[model samples]
Target: MSEQMIEIQTKLYLYDLANLAKEHGFKADDNWEFSMANNAERISIQKNYFPTNVTKIVPEILLQVLNSVRTALKQSLAVKDAPDAQSIIADELNYLVAFNPKRPRT
Candidate 1:
């Protein structure tokens, strides 16, 4: 897929995740940023989250996100001598965590 297409799709997917996270009480401090160079893509979210936050999200949505990440990771690795594999996966992992919910107001 073209880089532009990937960027658009990734953004949309993240948006959906953010909305779902909110519904489940995940808190985010900022937005996601996308950067690419030499076929290496980096996606970063402003805050960090926890694994429990992920469990709080709907299982179906988590499954969908997992699939999308797997596909994107696979596509990136398909390139000959891919250098950004670690970076890509790391960013995806961070994105997942960024949805960790904040403690409820007392």
Candidate 2:
């Protein structure tokens, strides 16, 4: 949970990474219906995709999760105390979304 360890250089660039993922989502036609779906519905349409411009909705979904956590903490009374929580969840989520398992870094 050490945010600095996840940091690139000294920029604390997790935000930049988040922003890039957001841009990718937007470019990928994130506004479409198929972009949002339930379990069965999603599996059904995995092959047939429209607005093929939308090649990266899954990342958008991860971004939404980060935003949702941010929103949750914003409304809470202890927002200042838990600043790193949102970033950590976002990082954990990116790890999960990107299928990055808990492997030792070389």
Candidate 3:
């Protein structure tokens, strides 16, 4: 995919995730950052507030967020618009889920 497409997809994914997080009772900050290294892009989702102690976000919420984004992406792709970029975003979301900090180790 082109750099422009990738950036657009990333923004879409972040927007979806942020909305999902807010719907799940989490505070999603508007301040998000992105960086590229080793030919890969990384996004940092910011939280409005931080807990003093270690907090483990439940995996269920993460799964819900992932599903929500996946569904939206599928719907967007159904219109035959930016299929490649949407697919990449979906794959990236899956990767996030697989390595989610909230998920239990198997």
Candidate 4:
């Protein structure tokens, strides 16, 4: 894959991971705070969000999700009756939507 495609894929994976984390009641913040006390002086520290147990599991889940997506894309592309790009996207969206926790099942 080209560099741009890899970048896009990484962004998508991170976006999905963030949404998944939020759904699980984890905070998705751009900034995280820490504190230090030394020699009777208080020090304030700020950095990006720290990884929790949930964040640690994200990589494994993301890899599985990406693998599934890749398999689906390959299968869709290999069909003798080729599906259009829109159809492929719609199918994938429907697959994802099926997992919505708030959606009422028929």
Which candidate number would show the highest lDDT if scored against the true structure?
Answer: 1
The runs of at least 3 residues in candidate 2 whose Cα sits more than 4 Å from the true structure, single-residue gaps closed, are 1-34, 50-63, 66-106
lDDT of 4 by residue, 45-78 (tens): 1122223112111221333343344453332213
User: What value does the lDDT take at residue 6 in candidate 2?
Assistant: 25
Model 3 Cα lDDT, one tens digit per residue, 12-39: 5666556655554543333322111111
TM-score of each: 0.28, 0.19, 0.30, 0.27
Whole-model lDDT for model 2 versus the true structure?
A: 0.32
Give each model's whole-structure lDDT.
0.37, 0.32, 0.33, 0.32
Clashing pairs in 2: 28-54
Please report the TM-score between candidate 1 and the true structure: 0.28
* Clashes within 3 Å, all models in order: 1, 1, 0, 0
How many clashing pairs in candidate 3?
0
Winner on lDDT between 1 and 3 is 1
TM match of model 4 to true structure: 0.27
By lDDT, rank the candidates, best first: 1, 3, 4, 2
Model 2, position 52: C-alpha lDDT score: 24
Displacement of the residue 59 alpha carbon in candidate 2, Å: 15
